[model samples]
Target: MKIEAHEVERRVETFKAAVQEAGLKLTHQRLEVFRELASSADHPDAHGIYDSVKHRLPTVSLDTVYRTLRTLSDLGLINMLGTAGESIRFDANTRKHHHFVCVNCGLVRDFENEELSALQVQEDLVGFGRVLETQIEVRGICNDCRNKS
Candidate 1:
């Protein structure tokens, strides 16, 4: 799921604005890191992003990539997925949407459903807690993986 060039540019602009607004310097490495994540839909992790960014920036360390990702996530410029015990994946799309996760291949795809979006958390689920957002993750085998088996 390749993002359009125009959308990528728009996201880059948003990223720059957000960085400046947060009083952070928009460095080359940070831009490259964001670009890599923005342009990708595969939901890459820190190591995956590091591998791609290292080609253009040979001096880039894995630690830098980790920190850059953390900063972007902290700034609400990106979304993080997966549980704490598992490897974390990053998604560039921050809009309201649900995910279809392939249990076999670990592929994650975004989808939008009005019904799902309108769902409300029941009081029984979170007694005194408030629900800020509701997102559903439907897990199943993807077509390719199902066919391969």
Candidate 2:
């Protein structure tokens, strides 16, 4: 899907009230990192985030970006996506959606195949009755990238 900058700005705007509710300062670095996440389709990692915002904030460290990403992920404002042998990728779309990853180029794109989401999960824990989280990452070649080979 083609998500635009305005759409991203709107999403971050939704977080302003909640950010304060969490007693967070919502500093310049925080906002800048989030805004970049919102606008990106690259499925960035902490290093990628640092690269994007470094020009504006030269001293922003890689550790700062990682910490911010963890905060955002904990706040339910973003998603940390990764596969069995991949670097952690940050997703701004916190919604329950799947992704198709390109093994060759490491490109990530939103996957909308609803049938996969409908698959059943086996519940085997007899005593534990609480379920709080589920994350699925599907791997494959993207259409354009597949066609190029």
Candidate 3:
């Protein structure tokens, strides 16, 4: 998905509004972190985010990036993909969509399908209570990895 400039601006604005609604302090670091996430198509971890933000704000620390990401995740502004065993990843596309995780390089990419979105949960599966969310992660080698092999 090609994220346009206006779309990034819109997401950033929405993020700002959410921060205000959550009564969280709005800092330049937070905005920069959000912008970096908003503009990224690759699901990035805290370290990746820290690397990106540090290019613009050299004084920014990894801890600041983590805290900003935590605050945004807590506010429901972003989706935290904890299932990534190697490293926790974050998705800016909060919409209902699945993921394609490349097993070779651990790359995460978004995937969307009407049928997947329309799936109905059985609710009685293992007595896990009501299912509030559903996300499918298809693990396999990506085109790049396949070509390399």
User: Largest lDDT belongs to which candidate?
Assistant: 1
- A best-first ranking of the candidates according to their TM-score comes to 3, 1, 2
Which pairs of residues collide in model 1? none
Candidate 3: the clashing residue pairs are none
Determine the C-alpha RMSD for candidate 2 after optimal superposition of all C-alphas: 2.9
Which tens-of-lDDT digit does each residue in 89-130 have in candidate 2? 888876567776788778887655567667666564466765
Error of 2 at 88 (Å): 1.3
Which candidate tops TM-score?
3
Ranking by lDDT: 1, 3, 2
Candidate 2 residue 137 C-alpha distance from true site, Å: 3.2
For residue 85, give model 3's deviation from the true position in Å.
3.0
- Model 1 C-alpha lDDT per residue in residues 1-149, reported as the tens digit of each score: 67789978988998899889999999999999999988887888999999999999999999899988988898888889975456888878777889998988788888889999999877455576766789999989999998999
Model 2 spans > 4 angstroms off: 112-130, 133-136
Q: lDDT of all the models against the reference?
A: 0.88, 0.79, 0.85
**Tens-digit per-residue lDDT, 24-98, candidate 3:** 888888888989998988888999989888989999899889988987898898988876356778888877899
Which residue pairs in candidate 2 have backbone atoms (N, alpha carbon, C) closer than 3 angstroms, thus clashing? none
Q: Alpha carbon lDDT of residue 55, candidate 1?
A: 96
Model 1 scores worst on lDDT over the 10 consecutive residues at 123-132
